[model samples]
Target: MSFSDAIKICFQKYMDFNGRAKRPEFWWFALFCVVVSLVLGMASSALSTLFSLATLLPSLAVGARRLHDTNRSGWLQLLWIIPLIGWIIMIVFLAQQGSSEDNQYGSTPAN
Candidate 1:
């Protein structure tokens, strides 16, 4: 998915954690968030903080959905607490392609 479409879908489903999110959607939105955060931080700390707070939930929701797409539980995100290795593992999980066949999560998201 394109960056704008990913961001739009993320915000539209801001609090939703039940569906699946494709790799492109999740990664594009992630890049958007990082770029926005960096730009806002360069402009003003307060603006950056506000943006981070505002996007937190949507980020988590999309992340959870992304995990679901990999056939993993959203709760697995807690592994990030484990430091470097944990972060690497989470990245690997999130970067993986979704299962071709449906598992416990919903059907594959349409491209």
Candidate 2:
């Protein structure tokens, strides 16, 4: 998916954690979040903090969906608490291609 579309979908699904998100969708939205946060931070710390808080739910939801696409539980996100290895493992999992066929979470997202 294109960056704008991904970001739009993420906002539309804000607070929704029950589906699968394709790699592009997740990554593009992630990029949007990072860029916006950095830009806003440079302009005003308060604006950046507000922006981060506003986007946090959608970010987490999309991330959960990304994990679902990999046939993993959303709870796995908690592994980030473990430091470097956990962060790396999470990245690897998120980077993995979704199963072409359905697993437990749901059918593969349409390309």
Candidate 3:
């Protein structure tokens, strides 16, 4: 998907974790989130508290979709409970490429 489309979908689904996402879609949205967070952090120091709290949902949504992209369940996030191993596994999973075509989750991301 295009960068703009990814950002749009990220917010459109904001909290959805059911569908699959491709690498471009996931990473671009991630970049959007990071940049937005930094900008918001600088622009509204007083509001940082609220923005920080609010960012959690979309961040989770992106992470969940990133998991789905790798053909893993979003529930894998719970693995974070297992000390360092879980975080490593999550990083590796996020780094891996999505299936080239469709898998059980859904169709390939829009071209």
The true-versus-predicted C-alpha distance at residue 104 of model 2, in Å, is: 1.1
Clashes of each: 0, 0, 0
The lDDT for every candidate, in the order shown, is 0.94, 0.93, 0.79
Question: Which has the greatest lDDT?
Answer: 1
Q: 2 or 3: which has the higher lDDT? A: 2
Candidate 1, residues 52-73: lDDT per residue as tens digits? 9999999999999999999999
Error of 2 at 97 (Å): 0.7
Clashing pairs in 1: none
lDDT of 3 at 19: 78
lDDT of 2 at 2: 84
- TM-scores of all candidate predictions against the true structure: 0.97, 0.96, 0.78
Number of the predicted model whose TM-score against the real structure is largest: 1
Candidate 2 regions with alpha-carbon error over 4 angstroms:
none
Measured with C-alpha atoms, the lDDT of residue 11 in candidate 2 is 98
Scored against the true structure, residue 48 in model 3 reaches a CA lDDT of: 63
**Residue runs of model 3 more than 4 Å from their true location after superposition:** 43-45, 80-84
lDDT of 3 by residue, 1-111 (tens): 788998888788877887777777778977876787788778896566577677678768877887887888888888878899988987788889888777777776665
